[model samples]
Target: MGERTKKQKLILGIQHTLAMFGATVLVPALTGLNTSITLFCAGLGTLLFHWVTKKKVPVFLGSSFAFMAGIMAIIGDSRMGDPDFMEKLASVKGALIIAGLVYVLFAGLIKIFGYEKVNKLLPPIVTGPIIIVIGLRLSGTAINSAFYYNGEFSLKSVLVTVVILTVVICVSIFAKGIFNLMPILFAIIAGYLVCLPLGFCDFTAVREAHFLSFMDKDIVAQLLCIPQFKLDAILAIAPIALVTMIEHVGDITTNGAVVGKNFMVDPGVHRTILGDGLATALAGLLGGPANTTYGENTGVLAVTKVYDPSVIRIAAVFAMILGIFGKFGGFITSIPSPVTGGISIVLYGMISAVGVRILINSRLNFGNSRNLLVAAIILVLGIGCDSIPVYGAVTISGLALAAVVGIILAFILPEGDDSVLN
Candidate 1:
């Protein structure tokens, strides 16, 4: 990829954009945030990430699914046409900004203490289940979104989802070489075409949408946060930054492994974390969801064997172009609900499967009581309950609590083999 012609880099960049499209837009769609702004922020954020890290890594930053629960808890309702939606969204943005700061704190800790300590503290036993929980916990939303039709299940959506799912899965398993790298993009094209004939999508919004608009329009002028502060929102959401930080390490580790370099050590983990943190803060400040090292884009890098950072930066530029054009954003927002559902089914499941892979790859001995207890507790704590009461009328919940619990258990419990999962 590094030696490719300029035209080839652009083509690969477009492919990377397509890989990130489904999951990236889904965050704004679910949280009722401005879709165009999200895209714009993602682009700007990626550029910022590159600058912060001295432009060494090829990772593309995008919307993070890990913070969905916190966003939902704060301002996530998509009902009543969302009369107060922006008000709720603005508040969430405030929390997300703080969360980004928390990410910086973790980055500093990593910089000072080094990766080995963080790795020992987190280990695959803790982080793997947390990843699985992040995916499995969102399963209900994925299914419900696919089947939902004016408050009723539709056989139409089911057929559509199934078709798309099948296409994606088949391409994933059977496609050879570079072809396997683009199943999501191909499947989406196939599904959207299927949706058009079935009357699942509305083209009217696209037609009515403006060709050019700044920041996704001035519609939410009042809702834009000028530093709206909420301690509760901070407490609810900020800690999850740490959870995503662990994920950042894994994502970078995976990217490095695939590209045949140790990004965690070369560009330095601290630099990468700093880049991600600043990018996320930019998203938060702009009333969008938090940003993270997108695993989907990393997957594309792995499959395509494109180690060049130029392609990802190009993809980031593409995202910004879509963001500045209101019409492109509108079309993406209006993608039929069920089409998203189909993608989510595969995506969320793949996430959980990655967790299982983490365990298998790490060789975490389930027969060992310590490993069993830690993993089991993290799952139940993460999926079974949303939060735990930590103070009078206050609670710690979501991935933050789940991750903290897992880390504590992993640290305190005795290892029968006196081993670190791997």
Candidate 2:
């Protein structure tokens, strides 16, 4: 292949950055973490992943949705007057640190046992449905935000939201070139623009904000190291590593398909997992969110036909540079909740659709008792019992619960002919 032109490389870099823009900020916004630090770590994580994988596949790392539950649970517990909320947060970080290490362990397992053995356990049948449920679960939040609820829902707001979402979906599916790649970003801008006439957004925060000030000082300090070490905290979060390891496999596979290369075999799954794990641990140590390969950026890659991994490295460099300063962070933090909510409705629904697609593409028999039971149990428990009591100190919610339940059922149930793990 011929070398990429400088302009092509620059375009690729910008596309990757824009693709990850909403998602990279969403994690920190939702979890009350440092947006700048999260972006910094995400970029760093992607670079590290590329390095370990020999720079073969073009994948950008971003915040993992898997840890959303853990973060919410910790924050919720803290709200309930748990005197050890900070301690619990520290422990959660510690667990993630260990979880990152677990990737190395799973990677070794794959090497020893072979990829098929692991694949047999987590076929699209299992993963697809879980992904769907995850999206559907968050859809409610999006819809609610689009239509203001002042103790009563507004029909006008709901109609407006539907229009916004429809426009986004249409553009994503039908638009060509750059338009197709940025459906979400465009949708958000359009939706917020429409809402401007409705008096739904407030720019007061932006006006009060300094043009060149860092966003969240507290988060930045914490990223510099605030939560001290405790063994219990490490143990609490480590179990999540088991599920995220599987997620890493799925991400690599998906990325490989996008780039038309077998990342699992070429750069080798073990090395890729190691890179992800280490980057995640480093992010956690510095009070940033856990990292994962972003599907949004993958969609951009698909749309742009740019397969260069170096573009992601450039994006990462940009993220690190942004992290050093604070004003950019403040600006992102100042984004209106309703605007985020409007976009999230579509993003979350797409996530669910991806899950359904996974199962459909796998051609799994839903009629089978084993398949039905596994899917039913995982969906309900994950979305239903989102909050599970753990040692009378913390609770689990959202993706973390869904993931754990899915893995447990996959392990316990008998594998059918279509099993991905067998």
The numbered model that scores best in TM-score is: 1
The best candidate by lDDT is 1
Taken over the whole model, the C-alpha lDDT of each candidate is: 0.76, 0.66
C-alpha TM-score for every candidate: 0.80, 0.75
Instruction: Kindly list the per-residue Cα lDDT of model 2 for residues 1-422, writing each as its tens digit.
Output: 26866765665575456546666878776876666667778878878888887887787888877676666555552521346545655665666677677777777777788866755666665676666565666666666766764545776567557766777678768887545645655655676676667766666645654443344455544555455546555545565566566556656665565466777778777778888888888888877788877656555555445677788787777666556555554444444455556666655665565566667666777777788888887788657764565643344555557666676777787866755432
Tens-place lDDT per residue, model 1, 1-422, is 12667776677687677667767888877877767778888999999999888888998888987777677777745532557765666677788888888878878988898977866786778878887776687688779878886679999988888888888778778987556656666777787898898898887768866787563335346235475668877776777776677667767765665576767777788889989988988888887789988766655654455778978999999888877787876676567878777777776676676677777877777878899899999999889887565533334556656778898999998888745454
Q: Which stretch of 10 consecutive residues in model 1 shows the poorest summed lDDT?
A: 215-224
- Candidate 2 TM-score, C-alpha based: 0.75
Q: What is the lDDT of residue 369 in candidate 2?
A: 72
User: Residue 216: error of model 2 in Å?
Assistant: 8.7
Instruction: lDDT for model 1, please.
Output: 0.76
